[model samples]
Target: MLSWVDGRPAELLSVRDRGLAYGDGLFETVAVRGGRPALLERHLARLAEGCARLGLPYDATVLRDELLAFSRQLGEGVAKLILTRGDGLRGYAPPQPAVVRRLLLGGARPAYPAEHAEQGVRLFPCATRLAEQPLLAGLKHLNRLEQVLARSEWQDDEHAEGLMQDASGRVIEGVFSNLFLLKGGVLLTPDLSRCGVAGVMRAELLAQADALGVPCEVRDIDLAELLSADEVFLCNSLYGVWPVRRLQGRDWPVGPLTRKLQAIARDLLDC
Candidate 1:
């Protein structure tokens, strides 16, 4: 494993970095194989977009070169890229000519259990509700307290992930991944315009579904709809796709459509 901070090789994060002090940054977790960052283009695009949204400077080409060089050191693993606003003044006010800090941490190979992927995973509804913040939604920002709190609600190792809802009790997504449900032959995923990170894998799946002529919807989802879903799944760039076997005592089949998605994901990730 290897790590670099602020364009220099380092092992420990500075306590004064704005990312640690104020969560003032953005990050992307990418799967690196054979020294290549998977979906590098998409990740860079998202990083640039996040920086623009936060009024930060981001040169994608430079960052790309840095990431390539960093990943080459790891051989194969997960590459976590973080861009922070740097050490700031004592308050929330923005600093003039902010010093941006870039960090690349390595070593996170896919280690999900085979049984969970083959038979599917079990989930439970988390009492935590994601806050509605359109400005921050869809960006993989540093403010992830909601996910941390929701994930902490469960201690059972058998439960792979927990489902979170919006403030209005509308089903949103899993703690660290996107949620998809198949109900009555329709593919439904939460509209992340209001909240939740717009996962790269989820976007790819949606595009695939569109090309394959599968009926798909992006809108508000209710818990009752999820409870009645014929099948459910969670996805992120790292884990690929995982079928949900159970959710709060509700059982689901690893149906044909879910398998089709899995096949596409495998091809995309070269797994």
Candidate 2:
């Protein structure tokens, strides 16, 4: 494990930091290969958007340099970038003239079972439902208690991921990955405008689908739509793509489209 705080090496954070105090921060989990961060531009773009949405001051150039340096030092692994509103006085109100803080942590790449990507995975149906908050939607903010609770609903190895839905039973995503389904030759994913994390890999796949003339749609997906799909898969920046074979007793074969997009995701992460 390695860590950096504001471009300098450190292992501790201020207790008064708003990120710790009130979850006033955004984070990016990046995959590094050969001393470079995969999907660098997309990660930076999301960070920029999050900073603007949260009214935090940021220097994209500085952050980029720090990320590059951190990844180079890490060599090959997963790098997590955390951007916070720095320390603040005791209150819910954000401090004026906030000084942003950047924290980078690196860890070894996860050794996920190859069968997950090769054969496919089963999903645990989580009872915890996501609350709709358009204001905070799609931003990978520090507040992730919802995900924590949902993930805890499962305590076995049969399921590789948990299926999460919004309060209205609309399928949104997996616990730690974005969800996509293929139906009638169309690649469909849940819209993050109302809730859910807008993953970098999801955006990349949608772009690739468009380039390859694969019909792609971003809209609300209900359980029925997902269950009746021709194929299903999950994606995140870390593991690329995992074809979903089972969910709540329903089974789906790893279809051709899933394979095609999975290959694309693998190539993107590899490069």
Candidate 3:
């Protein structure tokens, strides 16, 4: 694996980096295949939005070009890009003339079970509940303590991912993937306007589902509603879409809508 910092090749990080001091940054995990980064524009757009929300200046065009050049060299893998507010003294105050740092790291494509796509995978109901933060909601920021805590609840790979809910018991999303439920021919995804990351893959499928004449909605979904859905699936840029056959105790057959969307994602993402 290779790493880059601020357009320069490096491996060290200053202890005073705001991203480390106070989680003052945002990141994007992109799926790379055959010298191409999938859904790159969407990833860049989200990262730019996150930077803006966090009062960090960023250039999406420049970052996109950098990613393209880097992905070409890596060929096939995952590219993790972290944009941080550079070195600052020991305090919470924002630094003047922010020295933004862009850290890019490359890793091999993760090998997930093939059956996760064909049949489905099981999901564990997490005990860790997401705290509601409207201001930081939907942005993939550097703070990921909730995910870290939820993920630490389990140690087995039998459950590929864990389902998490908000303090109000609304099923928000998986640890890393976005949640979607098919019910009565309509698609329902959690309204991440108040929490959770509005992932790039989720946005793509929501738009593409409309083009396919599929009815889709973005709203709050509770555990009961999720359990009662016709079909369930989790998605991200890396894995594309994994049909969720089991969550808690509820089981669902990978429905026709999921199959159709999975086919579309596979073709587009090379998943």
Candidate 4:
């Protein structure tokens, strides 16, 4: 993997970097298409929001220019942007004048089976439950231990993803993506006000549904409601949209609404 540190090419990352020291950083995984980063604006916006929430200094224009230049050289693949509070002396307290280190890495594109998209994916209900922290919720920060544990629950290749619930036993979202269910001809997604990452594709789908005159709601989703839903799907920037063929022992159809949303996402991503 090729990498750039603080605007210069580097072979190895410093062990002292606060990102490694305290997970004190934010990272973004972007898909490169035709030498351009997909959803560049939305990705940058989320990055900036994360930095602001952490009280870190950032220059969006510089970051954008660097990412674009780096991505162009990659041709087509995944581009990862990592920004961390620079090295600091021993202590839990953050450095007053925090120095920022930015790293960009490029690598091979991810491969997803074409059959999964055509037929649909299977999901397992995870035992791990996300903690409620409104202040830290909805931001893609570096602290992702919850996701790490949730994803480790299953080893079956047939199951494509796992569904996570909140501490109150409310169906929240997937480990790395957002969840949406259709019931009685209405679409529903969990509200991210308390927990879960508010994915960019989820926002786009909501907008498309509004324009298409499809009824949609963002609210707390219970496990019972999810189990009784007519259809369910998962979505993320990288995977586009995936219809869930089965969850636990229950089966779901790849309904018309799912196909309509998938077409919209495919057009937006040009994939």
Candidate 5:
């Protein structure tokens, strides 16, 4: 596994980096196949949006080139790009004329269980709730303690992913993925206006659904609503899509819609 700091091979990060000090950074986890990054445009789009929201100085063109080169070097695996506000002094105020730091790490592609996609996965109902923070709601920022804790809640193999919710008890998403549900032949996803990461795979599905003339909605979803759904699935850039079949004693069949979207996602991930 190779790591790059500021676009060069290195393993050390500045101790004064604000990403370590105050979680002032953003990141993207991209899948690479055949020496090419998968869904690169969507990943870059999200990174650009995150940079704009965080006021972090970034050049997408330069980063894109670096990403391509890095993926080429990696050949096939996952590339994690961490963009930080760079080094700072001994206080909370950001340094004047901040220099952004780009950290990229390469790792082996995850080997998720075949049944996770073929049959389905069970969701652990996480007790950890996401706090409402409209400012950082949709950005995949460095602050991920909530997800870290939620993921830590479950330690068994039976649950493949944990379901998270907002403080208001509204269904938010999975700890590591976005959630989707089909109700009355309509596709619905939780709105990220208040919390949760707006994942690239989630965005791709929304667009794909629209192109296929499937009605879609992004709005607040409660546990009751989610439990009543006709079909459910989880998605992320890494593993494509997994049909969610069990959660909190309830079970769902791996339906036709889940399979359809799964195929679309497989194509997108080139898996």
Candidate 6:
């Protein structure tokens, strides 16, 4: 494992760090290959937006250069950048002239079953419902208890991912990936404006769908609509894309649109 703290090789953090105490931080999980990071610009862009939304100080240009250099040195794997508001005194009040900390860590890339992408994976409809917080919606912040609970509901290799929903029973996304459905040949992904993480790969696929002359929509998706869909898929930065072959006790053959988008995602990711 490779780790760097504030641009220096170190492993220490004050217990009073706001990120630890109150989940006050933002993180970016990047995929690296051949000594290069994939969708780096997009990840940085989202991180900067998260920092702004959370009122945290960040320098995109400096961070970009630092991460680029770090990714090159780390080579192939996963690089996670955790930016926190540094250590603080007691209470929820943020301190003055906060000293932001950047912790760069690396891990081995995940190796999933090859059939997960080639043939489609099963989905477990999670019982955990996400609470709507427009302020934190779509931002990859430190808080993730909802996903943690949802993920805990299943523990078998048969299901590669679990689907999450909002309090109103509207399907939001997968526990770790974004969700998309195909109905009558049109592409539809849940609107993340209210809940769920706004995935970088989902954004890429939406663009690709448009370029392919396929109709795409971003709105609410109910359980019935999801179950009735012609095809379904999940996406994230690392896995690229995975079709959902089974959900709600029903099975679906990996449809043409899913294959087309999978091909598009592979081309975009150069994987």
Models 1 onward score TM values of: 0.96, 0.99, 0.98, 0.95, 0.99, 0.97
- C-alpha lDDT of residue 210 in model 4: 87
- Per-residue lDDT of model 2, residues 142-255, tens digit only: 999999999999899999999999999999999999999999989999998888999999999999999999989999999999999999999999999999999877999999
Error of 6 at 257 (Å): 1.7
Clashes within 3 Å, all models in order: 0, 0, 0, 0, 0, 0
| Pairs with backbone N, CA or C atoms under 3 Å apart (clashes), candidate 4 | none
Relative to the unseen true structure, what is the C-alpha lDDT of residue 49 in candidate 3, on a scale of 0 to 100? Answer: 87
lDDT tens readout by residue for model 1, 141-226: 99999999999999988899999898988888899889999988899998888899998899899999999999999999898888
**Which stretches in model 5 have alpha-carbon errors above 4 Å?**
none
The model with the greater TM-score, 2 or 6, is: 2
Considering only N, C-alpha and C atoms within 3 Å, which residue pairs clash in candidate 1?
none
| Candidate 1 vs candidate 4, lDDT winner | 1
Global lDDT of each candidate:
0.88, 0.95, 0.90, 0.87, 0.94, 0.90
What TM-score does prediction 6 earn? 0.97
- Higher-TM-score candidate of 3 and 4: 3
Task: Estimate the TM-score for candidate 1.
Answer: 0.96
Q: Would you give me the overall lDDT of model 3?
A: 0.90
User: Can you tell me which runs of candidate 2 are displaced by over 4 Å?
Assistant: none
Candidate 1, position 199, lDDT:
89
Question: Of 4 and 6, which scores higher on TM-score?
Answer: 6
Candidate 3 or 4, higher lDDT?
Answer: 3
Summing lDDT over every window of 10 consecutive residues in candidate 5, give the lowest-scoring window: 262-271
lDDT per residue as tens, model 6, 105-141: 9888999899999999999989999999999999999
Candidate structures ordered by TM-score, highest first: 2, 5, 3, 6, 1, 4
Stronger candidate by lDDT (3 vs 5): 5
